[model samples]
Target: MTVLNGKGVLDGIAIGKIVFYQRKGQEAVKRHVENTEEELRRYQDAKEQEAADLKKLYEKALHEAGEKSAKIFEIHQMILEDIDFCDAITDTIKSERVNAEYAVKKACDTYIQTISAIDDPYLKERAADIRDISQKLIGILTNSESDTFTSEEPVIIAADDLTPSETVQLDKSKILAFITINGSVNSHTAILARSMNIPAVVAVGEELGLKYNGNNAIVDGASGRIYIAPDAETVRLFSERREAKKAEQEQLHSLKGKKSVTMDGKEINIYANIGRPEDVEAVLRNDAEGIGLFRSEFLYLGRETYPTEEEQFQAYRSVAENMQGKQVIIRTLDIGADKQADYFEMPKEANPAMGCRAIRICLTRQDIFKTQLRALYRASAFGNIAIMFPMIISVGEVRAIKQIIHAVQLELSGEGAAYNPETKLGIMVETPAAALISDELAKEVDFFSIGTNDLTQYTLAIDRQNPSLEHFYDAHHKAVLTLIRITAENAHKNGIFVGICGELGADLSLTETFLRMGIDELSVSAPCVLPLRKKVMETRMDR
Candidate 1:
C-alpha cells in the first residue's frame, strides 16, 4: 500500500522507518580565493561558529521547547546579523574572489531566492531560515561535523523543510514522526511539532523523498495519512487506529482538573494562548483558565532594538509570576501585519492586512506605546496583569487606548514604581470595525478577545495568506459567524467579558458554536487546551 495525504499539523501515531534527514555538507567549490583577507577571516570564523551553534540551539529550545521554541534560535541569531544577510555574504567574499564555502553558497542562493519571492507566507517561511543558517555556515566552512540524524530505530522524518535548528537538533526519542516536503502550519518545524507532542505532517509532496529510505511508514497524525510500504492488512488497519488515538489522548488527561463546564451548566473560561515567557509551561500543562493571548509580540520579534522597558518588565514579570494568580491577557505590540519587524522601519505596504497594524502600531508609536505601557504597568506588580489591544477599530481607538493607558498609569505612579492600579483593559474585537462597535467597544474595554484570525481575515475579504484563498477561506463564515455573533452580543450587552483568541479559537467545529455565542472565553493553543476542554465537556446547552 502507499497512501499519502498531507496537512495534519499534529496528532499521534507513527509506525516508522523512513528517515531522509541528511545535513552533513559537501557542495561548495568555486575556488580561486587568493586570500580575500583569509576569506574574510574564514567568514568571521564561520559566523562565530554559527553564533556558538545558535547559542546551544537557544538553550536547547529553552529547555526542550518553550518561549515559542526558543524563539527559533532568537530568529537564527537575528538572521546571523542580517545587513542584507551580511551584505550578501560580504559581497560574495569580496566580489567573487570566492571561497568562504563559495561565498556561503552564493549568499545562500541569493538569500533563498529573495525569500522565495515573498508574497509573504510569513516571508515564505523565512526560506527555511536561509536554509538553516546556510547549512550551518557551510558546515563551519567545510570542517563539516555532521549535525543530526543518526537514528538506529525510531524513524519517519522526511524533510525538504524543518529549520528551527533542524527541529532542535533531533533525537526527540529518535523521532518516530516527521514529514515535510515544504512546511508551514506556521513553521518553526510546525512550532516544534506542536510543542513536541510530535506526530506531524506538512505539505507532503516531492513524493516524500530519499526514495522511501528504510520503507515501512505509517504516520496518520489523525489522518493526514502517510502509509508508504504498508500492507499486512495495512498494518493491521493502522494498528487499531493507533490504539484509538492512544486512548483518546489518555482521555484528555482526565479532562485536566475538569470544569470547562457545559452540559447545561455553561461556565467556560478555558484560556491559553501565548508566545514567550516560556509559554507558561504549556499554560500550566494545559489546564489553562488564564492567559487569553499574551503574544506581546514575543518582546518584538527577533530583536535588534525596542525590547527595553526593562526588557518589557522582565518579560511581563515572567508571565506574571508564572501565572500563579492566573489571568495574564497582555497583547499590546502586535507588530505590523504578517508580523514584519525589520527594526520597525515599516513602510512598503500594499495592504499589509489593512496596513499600519495592531492598534496601528500602538497608536502611531506613542514612543512605542509608552514603552509597552511602562512594561505592562511594571508587570502589574507581578500577577493577574491584563491589557490587550490589537488591530482595533475605534471608539477612537478605544479612546486612544485609554489615553495611552492613562499615561502609563501616571508614569507608574510617578516612578514610585510597583504597579497594578486595577489593571484590566482590552480590545481586539478583530476589526469588522471592532465587530460593529461591539456596543461602543464594549463600554471601552474590560474584555473582548475574538481575534478570529483577523476576524476571519477581515470578514472574508479573504487573503488569509492566500493559498489561492483556501477555497474562499471561511472560518465558518456566516460572515465570520456574524462577526463572532456581533462580538459576542456586544460583549454581553456591555458588561464586557468575551473571548476567542483566533484560529477560530481552536475550531472543534466551532466548539458548539462558541458555546452558543455567549462565549465568555476560549483562547486556545496550549495543544488546544485539552481539545477545547473536550469540546466543552461534550456540549449540550440543553441539547
Candidate 2:
C-alpha cells in the first residue's frame, strides 16, 4: 500500500481505479511542404473546426457549469480568432515554407514561452490557455483525438495539471476525483472542482510512479491523502467515514429552510457570494438568505470589449428577479490586480494589488463606473438590489462613489428609466486603513462588508497568492481578528450592519468568535451556507 500526501482543495472521499491522463506531446516536424497554399488552407480549416468545437463547448458549459465558467471556452474561442495569432501562423507557413502543423507549433510555442517569461504571475498563467487552444488546433490538423477522459466506470484522474478549458470538458459522471501532480489551490481547476462537488487533491509530488496506473485508490480530500491498494481494515474505516460524511451532508440539507439563529435567539443572516447570475441557482439550492457579495467583475472578463449597459443590466436583473426580493449586493468592477481584462489597457504597475484597482479604477474612470452603476440601478427596479464598492480606504472615496451614484440616478431619471431610489449603498472594508477608520467610513455607507481575504493579506504584509509565503499568510492572526472586531464595533455603533464576505467567514471554527463579535451576517460560497447555518443554530453565545 502506498500513501501519498497532497494539498486538498475540496473536501470529500472517493475510492476508484486510477486513470493516468497524459496529454499527447506535439512533436514539430520541420518538413518543407511543396504547396504552401494548401498548407495555409489546412491551417485555416483546422482553426475553423477549433472555433466550432469551442462554441459547442461554450454552449455546453453554459448549461452545465454556468456563464462565468462557460467564459473559459469563450476565451479559448477568442484565442483561436485572434488576428495576430492567426496572422503569425499564416506568415510562418508561407514565409518558412513549413507544414501547417509545424508552423502552428512554432507560433504557439513562441507565444507560450513569451507569456511564461512574464514577471506577473497572472499573465504567466495565461500560457496555459494558449497551450490548450494550440493543442486543439494541432490535434485537428493531425487528425488525432484531443486530450480527453473516457471511461465506462468511475475513475480517479491523475494529471500533471489541468487547464481551465480541459477541466470544463471533463465528464463528471465518470470522474470520481482528481489527483494532480502540480496545481495551485487558487487555480481555476480547484475552483471548478469545488463548484462541481468533486473531490480533488493537488500538488501531490510526481514520485507516485506510473506503474501504479489502474490501481485501486482511495482519495481522502479532507485529509489530502491518497491511499493505493489499502489494507482491508483501512478500506473498511474509509467506507464508514464516507457514510458518515453522507449522513452529515443529509443533515445539513435538512436544515435548508431553518433560520440561522443561535441558541440565545441571535438571528444571523447567512448569505452567499456569487460571481454571476447563474450562481443564483446554487445560492437558492443552499438556502442562503441573500447574496452578500456579487462579484460584478465577471461580466468584464474573457472579452475583447467592455460589456454594454444593457448586457450588464440583464445579468444583474436576472439575479435580482431570481432572488425574489432577497437582498442582492452587487459589487462594482474589482479588476486591475489578479483579475484583469486586456481591453482595459491598464498601465502596468509595480505593485498592482495596492495600486490603481477597484474603487481607484472606478473613481478615475467614471465613465466605466457609471455604466455599471446605471445597470445596477436599472436592475434594482426588478427586485431588491444594492451596490457595493470594493477596496475603499477612506471617507473621501466613499463620498466620491456616492456622487457617481447620484449622477447615474439623475441620468436614469432623465431617460425616464424606472429604478429603485432607495437602493442600499455599501463599501468593502478590506485594507487596514479602512478597518481602523471604519467608524468614519461607516457613516457614509448603508452597510459594511469586511473583505477578510484582503484584510488578512494586507495586515500580515503577505502576498497570499505566493505559495512560498503561504505560511506567513495567517487569516486568523491576532491583528486580523482585532481589525475585524474594531470594524464590527464601529459599524454597529454607527447604526450600520457589518458582515464578513470572505473565505474566513466560512470557517466553522471561527463561527463562535464572529457571533460573539456581533457580526450581523456571514456570507460565503453556496456550499458553505448550509454548514454555516448548522453552526449558527448550534452556537450558544450565552455559553
Candidate 3:
C-alpha cells in the first residue's frame, strides 16, 4: 500500500489497475507512409501528376494562415525530404543500436525531442504516438506479445498518462475520471477532459497494486484521491460529498443570468469565453453577461483555404445574436503556436512559440486580418462588440492595426457593410514588453484585456507547453502579479478598463487577488460563468 496526492472531481466506486495511456497514433501514420511510398512512385510515373501544384497550394494556404504555421509547414516538408524517419527505422533492423526495446526507445526519444521542440500543442501531442509506434514495430519485429486482455465488467482504470485520443475513446459512461501519474495542466488530454466536463487528476506517482478485478472503491477527481478498497463509512461519506457537489453545481447553474455582484455591493462583470457556434447555446442557457475572448481559430482549421468573409460573419453573428444586448469582446484570430487549425497546412517549426504567431501573424497577413476584422465590424452593428488584438509587443503594432481598421472602414463603406464606428478596439497585453508599456498602449486601444496565459509565459521565460518549465510558469508568481498590477494601473490612468480572459479568471479563490490588482472584468468559459458570477456576488471587490 502507498499514499499519493492529486486533484479531480470525486465519483464513487471505480477500482482497477493502472493502464498507461499515451498517443498510439504512430502505427496508423507509419502505415500510411508505407502505403504512400508506393503511391508516390505511381504518381511520379504518371505524366499528369500535380504534386508540385498541391505543394504550392499548401504553401500558399499556410502563408495566408500565419508565420508560425508557414514555418511549421516548412518543417513538415523537411521531415518528408531530409529526415528519412522511415528509412532510419528500416536500417535499425540491420544494426541494432543495442537491443530491440532500446532501439525503439531511441527512436521514440529522437522523434519526441524533434516534435517536443515544436510550439503547437496539437502537433506536439503526436510525438508520444511516434514512440508508441516504434515500440509496437520493435515488438512485431522481435515477435513479442502485446497487451491483449479485455475486461468485461466496468472497472475504474488508472493510468500513468493519457493522450487526447485515449481520453476521447474511453466510454465516459463506464470510465470514471482519469488519473495520470504524469501530465500537465495544459495538455490536450487535460483540455479534452475538461471540455467533456469529466473529472481528472494528474501527476500521481504510481506505486500501488490496484486490482484488475472489480472492487468497490472511491475516486475523488477533484481532490485526486483513489481508494483501492474503501471502507463502507468512507464510501458513504464520499457519496454524500458527491451528491452535495452535484447539487452545488445545480445551484450554481440556477444563478445564470442573475448577477455577479459581491456581498459588499461591488458589481463585477462576468462573461463567457467561447469559440464555437454550439457554445452560443451555452452562453444563452447560462445567461452569460457577455462574450469575452471569442477565439477564431476553429474556423481556420479543417480546410485548404481560408474561411470566406460571409462564413466568418455567420459564426460571429451567432454569438452576437445570442448575447442580444450584452457586450461581447471578440479577440481576433489567436492562431499560430498553440492552436494551429489543420486548414493552415502549416509546416513543422523549430521555435514556433517565439516565431510569428497569433497577432504577429495578423500583422503580416493583413489581408486575412481584414477579413476577420471586417466580419467582426459587420457583426458589431448587430451587438455590443469590442475588438481585441492578441500578442501585442509594441505601440507600432497597435498603430498599424489602427491603420488596417481605417482600411477596413473604407472597404466596408465601399461594400455598404453596416458596422459600429465607435466599437471599442482593445489590445491583449500578453507580453512583458506590452505590460511594461501598457500606459502608452492604453492611449491607443480603447482598453487592455490582459491575457495572463501568455503574459506569464513570456514574462517568466517559461514555455507554458513545456512541462520541464512548468514549475516556473505559475500565474501566482510575484513577478506576473506585479505586471498585472502595472497593467491595471495604466489602464485606469488612461480612463480605460482592463479585463482578464484567462484560466485564472475562473479561479474562485483568486478573485480577491485579482481584485487587489484592480482588474475591471472577468472572462471565463461559458459553463463557468455562473459559478464565477456567484463567486463575484459573494466577493468584496474594494480590497
Best-fitting candidate, scored by lDDT = 2
Residue-by-residue lDDT tens digits, candidate 2, 1-543:
999999998899999899898777666678888899999999989987887888777766765665446666766776787888999999999999999988888888999888877675455556667887887888888888667678999899988888776877888889999899888776667767876778999989886668779999999999999999998999999999999999999999999899999999999999999886878998999999999999987788765799999999999999999999899999999988777687998997999988999889999999999999999999999998988999999899888888888898999999999999999989998999999999999889899999999999899989876655656678989999999999999999999999999989999999999999999999998878998999989989886
The lDDT of each candidate is: 0.81, 0.87, 0.67
Ranking by TM-score: 2, 3, 1
Judge candidate 3 at residue 46 and give its lDDT.
25
For each candidate in turn, the TM-score is 0.38, 0.84, 0.75
Clashing pairs in 2: none
Which one wins on TM-score?
A: 2
CA deviation > 4 Å runs, candidate 3: 1-127, 131-155, 158-162, 179-191, 201-211, 341-350, 541-543
For model 1, residues 181-298, the per-residue Cα lDDT tens digits are 8786767788888777788998888877787888888988766779899989888977898888789989998889888997788888888887778768878987888889888876
Give the backbone clash total of model 1.
2
lDDT at position 69, candidate 1: 69
Q: Which ten residues in a row have the lowest lDDT in candidate 2?
A: 118-127
User: The CA-based lDDT of model 3 is what?
Assistant: 0.67
Local accuracy of candidate 3 as per-residue lDDT tens digits, 310-329: 99998888777777888888
> How far in Å is the alpha carbon of 226 misplaced in model 1?
13
lDDT of 2 at 374: 92
- Worst ten in a row by lDDT for model 1: 465-474
State which candidate, 1 or 3, has the greater lDDT. Answer: 1
Q: Model 3: which ten-residue window has the lowest total lDDT?
A: 42-51
